[model samples]
Target: MLNWDDISREYQSEIENFQMLNTPDERNVRAFLQNCALELHERQTAVTRLYFDQEDKLVGFFSLHNDLVKVSPSLILEHRWNLITEGLTHFPAIKLHYLGVDARYRKQGVGKYLMEEVRSIAKEISNYSGCNFITVEALHSSLTFYRDRGFKLKDSTAEFHNMLFSLETLDNPTLEATPLISKQKIQEIRDKVMSVIEQSNLTYAQVAATSGLDEIVIEQMEFGTDVDVETLASVCQSLGIRFL
Candidate 1:
């Protein structure tokens, strides 16, 4: 089981215990979570979110802030470029300041889950404002990781590689539809998922393993967390629960 929430002082002790790979970039990630994440959060400079695993131990975290991406005209689609002013190239973006998963959870989809959450948050922000992309200053060693996840390098020669993921690749539900999701509706869905889980008498881990997903994924569904529809469908199928 894994859960995420905004960072707070109560997590200081756990944050102190958090560990990452020994590489320089991973070290900086740990240092940021310990030394700066909360302060930055308090100041409203950057908002940080922490991930905790089954034992309620802090295992991962990431910080995000609003940003602007300046690029040449050629870099953007003509229609997108046309949305900008005659001379300006700045595009609204959400910057991922730091992202790190515990060294122990590295290959178990923690990183992938964190990235998905970031992208989901970016999309939600897009519904309220003009968020066109998610940007990150990538470490050289992690270049391939980000690249494989749909981020494109803005400049290979830069000290910190600038990577961008165009949000246009994701579906943009109409504004009317966005506001239609009320808490009650969300609770109903969660209850439905729980009912299905109870009927199946299968644990989250069992369904997750059969569905090729993390146990936390099923837990998230039952807890009313926002999950991709594909994941929801897969979990349902795994439990022999049909969608109406």
Candidate 2:
């Protein structure tokens, strides 16, 4: 049976050899593995998980990170799930940042297997964290691939589709009872994040440099502007903090 493992030094060689033909996916996989995966993993920016065959060859990989999803009022009304209240505008989620299968394993179920693993991880996180969705920004060509697996488009643009899979669908009673975050709660969390940054003895410029974010955005975040979950995650990673 194929086994899933966290990306580590032991698999570096195999990771270096793994390739996917899809240009964007290929570039991202190679870049992350070659330049950032290890540092990102150590900083808690994102965690890359690998799928290895019986011979221990790395055949595929996916990265997971915390994110926030903004549910449009129309989508909220249409779905009407417990995770989103009429008053709720945004919620935390787990993002599948990148997923790629070796070209040789394309239609042999490796992609599905990785997705199943992602769902399992998301389900486990929901038990302790306030995460409610498993999200992905999929390439245009893979729209049907994700839709067929129960992912619904939360939104879309010319370049990608933002999709979501609600954990509530897993029927975990605890998820049903989880309370929606209030505005006050959001402020409190933001305050805590600022505190972490201050405690780290790092300036906004330093954080921007380390996280690859614009310094002005970090300044705005410090002054209470709303930033996307991905941005917040990058900032947290730079500060050695956990956004979720």
Which lDDT tens digits does candidate 2 get at residues 1-244? 5788777887778877877653564576567776777778778899988888888778888899999988886775676667546578889999998887887676466877888789999999988889988899877445545665667788777567899987887774322222345556556766777898788787887877687555666776787765444455566677777565
Candidate 1's residue-wise lDDT over 37-129, tens digit each?
999999999999999888887778899999998877767763243345568778899999999988766546787789889999999999999
In terms of lDDT, model 2 sits at: 0.74
List per-prediction Cα lDDT, in the order shown.
0.75, 0.74
TM-score of 2: 0.65
Minimal lDDT window, size 10, model 1: 172-181
lDDT of residue 180 for candidate 1: 37
Q: Which candidate tops lDDT?
A: 1
Scored against the true structure, residue 72 in model 1 reaches a CA lDDT of 70
- Model 1, 32: alpha-carbon shift in Å? 1.0
